[model samples]
Target chain A: MSEEKKRKKILEVKDLDITFETTAGNVHAIRGVNIDLYQGETVAIVGESGSGKSVTMRAAMGILAKNAVVNKGEIIYRYCDNIGGIDYNPEYDENAVWKEADILKMDKKWIRKHINGRRIAMVFQDPMTSLDPTMTIGKQIMEGMIWHYKIDKQDAYNRAVGLLKEVGIEDAEKRMKQYPHQLSGGMRQRVVIAIALSCNPDLLICDEPTTALDVNIQAKILELIKKVQKERDIAVIYITHDLGVVAKVADYVNVMYAGKIVEVGNINEIFYDPRHPYTWGLLSAMPDLGTDDERLYTIPGSPPNLLHEKEGDAFAPRNAYALEIDDKLDPPMFEITDTHSAATWLLDPRAPKVEMPKELKLRIERMKKEAQANGSEL
Target chain B: MAANYNAEPLLEVKGLKQYFTVSKTFMVKAVDDVSFKVYPGETYGLVGESGSGKSTIGRSIIRLYDPTAGTITFNGMDISGKMSRQTQKDLRVMMQMVFQDPMASLNPRKKIKDIIGEALDIHNVCKSAAERDEKVEAILTKVGLAKEHADRYPHQFSGGQRQRVGIARALILNPKLIIADECISALDVSIQAQVVNLMKDIQEELGTAYLFIAHDLSMVKYISDRIGVLHLGHLLETGTTDEIFNNPVHPYTKSLLSAIPIPNPELEKNRIALNYDYKTSGIDYTKGTEHLIDGTHYVKCTDEEYAKWTK
Candidate 1:
């Protein structure tokens, strides 16, 4: 795992603040967000709707709507010259110094030519909307390569077939002749993934890619993404609300609330030793296969309305372990370890140490025991 | 809860089949020969993925789509299709459906009071305008909404609030059975728990049975008394919640259970997903029969496979 620390940073989002200008008021969607994605690693941003998970990723990809306002932030993307080359050292380059482009600062035309769908690609939540119903699967897949690389139709078709096979589609040749409606939901999502990977991108952003799929299909998609990530050695950012999906795929987890990340840590640290009360609530709310409880441990209230300016910590109202200071002032992120940090009043030196819910503690213990029994790394 | 098990079932669906003809050449058997019973005041969960015919069963039972072949007995009365006007009205009051998309189900032009009170008006349940208003207010509060919400439109509410309005519309007439077709799946995880708890509370207070159809197995295990697993329009397993969770007999049931993503990092890292192949398993569905494993558990398998599974 020491090699993980040596991984180079591919994208860095610093102090991001985004707002949407609505008819009623300006909705502050993202609040001082900070995140870094390392090459060949998977980072998951977990949150409910209106928590700004999608907005952050959309901002990174330069796809924010016209109504959106980037109040203050920089989305710096590092371009590695030796990607898809032999013996690639992501850390440093002696010959061609890596070029860093601020996606927020670049115009739409510049980003389209230099970054979007070539250096960075995105897979949306719904494949029905992302894909064109009129076009055949073969044409749709080949269109990206033909546009970006100026490749011939024959070569693009060959690569498209190879991509379909790589994504585990049976009868790749026959499937290419069909339209989007001819495929199943799972199959459509796989085609979308294939299209995203057609350009050999350096970063892949999946926004709830598997939410529309069944459980069995979801498992297959997650496995396919992991396999492709390793083979391509590209950075991945998964934006989803399902903690279960986060547990299975993410190397690091960021727990978002209202509009800010309340906790950020490695997967094991966030799941086993969570610091924020919001994280605890999220973990307890999910019903596990072994759970026999009468009632789910639901978070007390709904998410805050972003139309108005927030006073303190946005999650303080629903947090059962909230301190008085939480309502008075927002807490800065307190570092627990080099890889773990949380923005909660409970982490303050002056605040009393609060224990997690009994149910979560017991669940964590059982999970640790199961992991040890299976001889698996968490 | 156990005492209610001895009572008559609120809804009984037997040999239900709904088929849609796509073109002149072929037909799609969306639901085929499915059967289940929902006891009074008990939640009977129907679990399956898309194209598994779970949603078709829900729509068929509520008479939105006529069943090709089957008998639907609600309150010990056959109301499958082409019911008389009076019989239709009576059945409509006794059974209500909450759709998956709240935005599409409720009308934009209609106010919340009119939407909730439409059934009352149609059935002539309320004699006066004041009584209708009172009933609407009562149901709005029952679903954790205020009376002022009745004057607003459905677009004014959030997704969770719109779902509450949908529940209020369903509960306004005190239906004996509610067919909730993926009602909470559209909401967030936190709001989903709230809605599930609300459904449980409403069941306790009003004794309303539910045909809860969803793909999430964990939520089904929590709220359901009995569960029916569907795969390719076949009811492969039916058992009590504990029986189904602890001792799933069918290979399809095992695969479905194993496919669920558990929300624990350490446990999920070691989780093994079981894949079931129909062609490789060599279990023919034509000769498949439902065998009783224990008091309340049943598994669909052939004679030889049933013996092997039981052994």
Candidate 2:
């Protein structure tokens, strides 16, 4: 479905640039990222660590590290509620007219009051670190509702218990009384999700929420997120490195590499007819359960240094299909279809043809066998 | 059958148990009467969760942690009982270990050459310093690292490169069995493929055995010939990789297999979620140590549902 035709766009991040002032040098962590999230769709921004996916979402929630500075970008939010607590001029509110605020330039106090946890809630990867050891699970869930919504005590308790049940937690009333240590890692994550969903925010950003969880627990957490998104109709931006998780959860995928998104497409487009060489490598590298390849294919070379501020494509050094032009100038994103595009020199019409690795060809063939066995394909 | 009985496995464990006293008196049986065998030129995968004691098994087998009870037999030699300092040093060369955290396992100040050569020096395997250096270079190349990288410190390399150095250090001693305890868990998925492939190639080249311990079921199935599942210090199931994935006898193993997210989007969306009760499924591992007899597999275990799941 087209994002615009939906009721409203909750968040629109345009041309975002993020840099970190480090001891070594100024690291350009995010370079010109643009994203749009409709009311309820789950858009997963996926890549390996240091891919700037987390930085982009952290910018949206106004939660960046001390050294981070946004060089350029506008994070615009259109909300029925004044999440930022700014003086609402009734005349300023119109159809699709987002409150265009330079998130980088916004005051810390204003952003804290309006943006964070009030309208945009986040659930991080590690629950042990994220959760306060001193507090009970019930208090943690109630704390957000009381702070943001200012609801009554008994009502907050009721909502907290209800949320626990909503996320498929058994014995919600009893679970609410327990401390963080009493619960397993999976249950602790569910409690964290309950806290994030308690606010009923416009956007829910999950940064590798299940990376610390086991496979079964990871599946359960992903299912919980999907359920919450469906019921609350909140826009979700799932940040993760696992493509398997992305394929299961994301409706649209943005492949990031070294602070820049090299490809963006529908799930099927990216998986089936990928245009970028990096995307091809990533797809092939995934260990197919059904495949019989003697050796698994690996993408050679490491992620580039973000601190160096490379002039060309950051992935050019590692990309096997890199052209002469790729080494000198950054390739513009080429439009493959109405909904799909990739930033690669090889996609240029003038560039010579280079087929995907032979192992990848075999992987696709094996994937076809799986499709036939499963009786479905994109 | 005679071939299976007569042939000597590269590594064997009989009733291996490691119990830690969590409180003043209450001891937590982290690994209780777990036993398995690793055949030569084969990969045996150990799968478990955080408290499952999979890593404890890996450590105890390589003598990193002293086991409370049970016997560890390496190449028909019982190395379980207390050994002399010299015999222990000699055993270290036969069995090497690769830890999960490459950055922490490797010393940041030391060069790659010194890290690999230290084992050679400790075992007195090398004729001289030059011979040790040459062996380190050869193993570095074998593990896909450049010969020049031997001079660089750990801080200069990436996570994947550091893991390669770790592999090289383990392989330089010409160890018969390498225990990789969650070796690729900390790496990126794309880079993880490279490390796994490197391990497979090295094993094929040297005819070395591997005891691969990981929580990732799919990767275990991909790399291992035989697989063992551990839950709460109990070895619940053991079989071939294909049998474990396709026809899991135990409910826990079945649930674990079903839990792995399929790459296909449609299948993943349509797959039915398995709901196994964690609280009831957990055995009273604290008590019943006397009744728990070690056999080919966990039989008449306290977790009856898990034991009966196969029946």
On DockQ, the leading prediction is: 1
Which has the greatest TM-score?
1
Q: Clash number for every model?
A: 0, 2
Candidate 2 on A1-378: residue-level lDDT in tens? 454563566688888998999999999999988887777788889788888888898888787999998888888877665433322332355643345555566788877766777678899999988899899899999998788767789999998999999988899999888899999999999988898887777788999999899887888899888878877667889998888888788888899998888999988777767788888988888877876567877778778889897878899888877878887899888999987999998888998987877776766666656766888844
Interface RMSD of 2: 1.6
Cα-lDDT of candidate 2: 0.82
Scored by CA lDDT, what does every candidate get? 0.89, 0.82
- Which 10-residue window in model 2 chain A sums to the lowest lDDT? A82-91
Q: How does each model score on TM-score?
A: 0.96, 0.90
Candidate 1 lDDT over residue span A1-378, tens digit each: 355467878899999999999999899999999999988889999999989999999898888999999999899999866543323454455676688989999999988876778778999889999999999999999998888877789999999999999999999999999999999998999999999999888899999999988898898888889889989888999999999899988999998887898899999999889989999999889887766788988998799898877688888888788788888899999999999999998888889978999999998888777777777665
Candidate 1 steric clashes: 0
Worst 10 residues of 1 chain B by lDDT: B1-10
Recovered share of real interface contacts in candidate 2: 0.61
